[model samples]
Target: MKLSALLPFARLLCVTTLVAASAAQAQQVLNVYSARHYPSDEILYAGFTKKTGIQVQRVDSDDAGIVARLRAEGAASPADVILMVDAARLWRGESMGLFQPVKSAVLDAAIPATLRGAPDAQGASSWYGFSTRARVVVFDPAKVKREDVDTYEELGDPKNKGKLCLRSGSHPYNLSLFGAVLEHMGEAKTEAWLKGMVANLARDPKGGDTDQIRAVASGECAIAVTNSYYLARLMHSTKPEDLAVADRVQVVFPNQASWGTHVNIAGAAVAKHAPNRAGAIQFLEYLSSAEAQEVFSDANNEWPAAKGVKVNNSALQRMGGSNFKSETIPISAVGGNSLKVQQMLDRVGFK
Candidate 1:
């Protein structure tokens, strides 16, 4: 019930796994069910092992799969911790009772409170978002003026009809964005924006963020909304097509006046019935540490959750350079209304 009450159990969990899963010389292992598959995570996990002596057994899959599996596993789930991209998935998982509230002053200080909703948000989604990511707008400089779009609502303006590029609304990323919109502007305003966004789509929503960027490059649309990291990855990519796509799209942070760019998180939390609990919390602490965060950010092309972390890649710098000002609303609100947002997406004719 109370967070203070959970701390003792959470701490005992940390030590219990080290005993069960490890020999004297062997490090305690944490089985992490992660929604992230970026090669950068592997590097960070390796670094965590080297630093904390805890072995990371990561299972990569989509958020839905991890949540569903955790639910199916129930008390027997081998998963000690979970890492996921969108905040909604974390909240969704929390709602399903897949995660337990973990208490750590270090983590509390390290992660922002707004990022980690209390269990009340889901009555079970006890997890919190740790990493920073923004859903932003990008355009072909030659095709669209920077000032032409600032707020997400403007993308749906009639004059810009059929001039915007975006991915499927069902995509968790777009769902999160719409979730944020719904939080701030209410269901009515958000639905209107979605309808406008659907009408302005250059074509049926199909493909990932890169595809939207590619569409912009190929004259499919003048403007596209995507994560900052996607554009950063494209810029640094060795692949010619991605490089060309990067060359064509110009990055812009939207909704700066009221709701800065919509920033979401990829986060981790200990399982409620974790077979290896302490190891899991240590693993979470390890991830938020400077060393792991740096490696994760650099290798994965993402912004670090902890502050004052330097960004090495020039491409990352060019794409807004790690500003975490964030949108005015909490990511949990996005998770809470994800279903309504998806329905709106469909109602607006976004395929």
Candidate 2:
């Protein structure tokens, strides 16, 4: 078995198969508004179609755009489920009361208490996060010494100032990272880190992770903070662009000793007024099963939210002993503080 092919739908949890079957037979369709653009997701949809005969209507778009569109759709929003990356966005949706609360033994039992709900009763179950991603720094082993760096806090040190590059602080990934920082290190430490990190930037923060990777590879910068999956994509892609990026950078898992790494998720939630609550619950359940979790991880380097999903490939395990520890604070803290993070970024001239 090819390593990535180890996960399939059958071995994974389908949540509520009988519920899905009944819903499918009723001529109803599940309308999904997703910010995820993985080709593997299509396989998930295809499997769902084949097994239950439910039409999975998915409209893929930027997470923020879809949220805005859904909000604009107001009472007329036809979306059954909403999915996206970055925890702050999900927290925003919950803060705005955009998604509704849903309870299923399957979901509650399958998801850890931490990932399934918001911080409190005020924002409970607005949504649940599933597949996960981590924000870590990577570098070229041949050009840089990996032993010198460990935590995100170290990236801003004066000794390595000019050698580092990062994407814009305004991006969701940074915001979520900032949120995690604020939650763990307090606002003061986070502010200090941001100020120092911003000052240390090898160049003006202006592009996506891909851009940062390019900068590192082209000798424009020696270190770049990026998601793990970007390497997987670049290494596996037939595209010349990805190939070039892969040639320049080597993946380095950050904070291996201090706290493993900072992580966030790509997950889903049903609408508050969903007419097919049962079906939506079924869908949520499927997302938690070992099958979907494995497919997500092996397919795109995404981590699974469910407890028992096999997520560590050799490359991931070798970096750190898969004893990953996520920030205890929920993303609502980040969502609530996103504006604060922006203000701080502006004050520090992170532009």
Candidate 3:
């Protein structure tokens, strides 16, 4: 009597176990809190899902908002990965203890050491930079000679006064560039240089890099500071007006004769309390892979951060030659000095 009665119950329990296991397998997910606003990132997410059969859930927000949300949620946060632009913001999150140190041989080998977090003697990284954009000086050739704008310092020269445009000081792009200068030139010299730049402003800092490029195109400003990708985007835009703007200006890889051009990154980190740690690491490593880096970077007109990988965007390539040199100052130093640069900008009346 007991065998017949127990057999049905045992079968029901086995079926239930299998069903639960299948559901868990199907639900394998990686949640991302990303500050990167690029539209092409969707494609990268899709590619990862296609390759690994793991789903990706994403929320897009400003860098500050992402940081605040992660802090509020703490260990219960659903974020498996934190993706953001700018080295300072990544460093800010790392400093706040938002990320866990990761050791992936793929990440270590693919990403350049200079672009990632400072490694201890053990060489584990807290964050990895996958793509980079150069902060360069864009000038209208009709109004300014290339020889006169050979370096970033030249923009602040008294002769260039009333002819330069810049984005607001608070923007991370400008701050990172300034931070790099502070690292290279001491505080006093950096402060003085900031003051000189402020004095040369064609107009008070107002819009973003794209707006600064547009201003240069329209003759509102002769020279403007902007990321190379912005100009590349303009050149690649389908809109005739954007192409016109691209044509009106040309790029100058500032400090080429000395420190090389300043660049910043759009990077990623694994969450400190990630629920799916393995998946997050896999995704991060995928992001560093040559294929993913090319798609991720070329989509935004950025250069890949992987060593030996080349940026194929003709527009970006034309802006800076293959031999273009990047400043050797570690990006972490730029992030570390972000606040100091901000303070200097404030003191100098850099709007």
Candidate 4:
């Protein structure tokens, strides 16, 4: 061929190579919509990027906000991964068809079956719980005996009347707990339990889990329910006030003799319309790794969702949660009960 002909061919090859390179670079990016607002979670993302060389771009919001945003965006959404802090919210997303099922051996092998979404016919899961927090009873030892508030059922006992503190019943944390209780106790009994709790309210429900803990410490209430992590934060705090609050309250992992304590999760899923599905799945797998599990425990005060992963959080150990019994109920079932539980809460005026 003549030099002029060869020159055009060479230019065409160069342009094609450039375009392929650009496309490959674009494929290395992963977009995440996260409901976990904790600053400590930054380490989790950074670690994934370091390991895979896949850059992560994240949008942070509360669980409800993230779910709403995903729904609003629908098929046109740019979200590749969705990280939510509650089992109910994850279930809500899954029920709404917001997540595409993922088939990952790493996830299946690492996480417990109860901590992940139900498998589809093809044996793929729509979501996986990366970390867990037990919903525990916290009480003032002076006013409430350890045995008195040892189980969830005791919370609604008339003997403990005018001594309970709770957050809004409609909150996702409460919804998940109530849903789990509904699974164990059945609907009619669950409704009655909620009514009893309403009658026992030390004050109208109004506060976050941490606030509930402080209310116990300050004597505003004798007994309260809170996620383990919230209490762990106080237990691990450097401040004297926080330590005092931790010291003033005794935590009980309820139902240890029976079905076990209700545990909630912070879970993740691949968006249904993920533009980078492979990268999103990779991120989910990374979250189940031993290293990532440890970070979740140490930084966020949550327990590792992956089986056999060890955590070094002193707060967890101090609270005797290292070997506490947790309910084996499938989290999906608990989340599915959210609506029914909420309605029961409304009928009982549980706030």
User: How much is the lDDT of residue 130 in candidate 2?
Assistant: 85
Considering TM-score, where higher is better, how would the candidates rank from best to worst?
Answer: 4, 3, 1, 2
Give the per-residue lDDT of model 1 (tens digit) for 65-146.
8877887888988898888888778778877778888877667767666677664543433666656777888888887778
Model 4: CA > 4 A from native:
2-15
Highest TM-score among the candidates is held by which one? 4
Where in model 3 is the C-alpha error above 4 Å?
A: 1-27
lDDT of 2 at 33: 88
Give model 2's TM-score versus the native structure.
0.85
Question: 1-351, model 3: which lDDT tens digit per residue?
Answer: 789999999999999999999867745899999998888999899999998899999999999999999999988898999999999998899899999999988888898888999886788889999898888888999989998887888877898989999988878888899899888889998899889888988888897899999999999999999888888888889999999998888888888889999989999999999988899999998898888978956787888888888778888877863568889888988998988888887788888
Cand. 2 Cα-lDDT:
0.75
Tens-digit lDDT track of model 4 for 1-351: 899989988999999999999979877999999988888999999999999999999998887788788889989999999999888999989999999999999999999999999999998999999999999999998998999998899998999999999999999999999999999999998999999999999999997999999999999999999999999999888999999999998989999999999999999999999999999999999999998999999999999999998878999988885699999999999999999998898888888
The lDDT leader among the candidates is 4
Write one digit per residue (lDDT tens) for candidate 2, span 267-318.
Answer: 7989755656666777888888887777777776777788777655544554
lDDT of 4: 0.93
Clashes in model 1: which pairs? 13-278, 14-278, 94-124, 94-125, 95-125
Candidate 3: pairs in clash? none
Error of 1 at 166 (Å): 1.2
Superior candidate under TM-score, 1 versus 2: 1
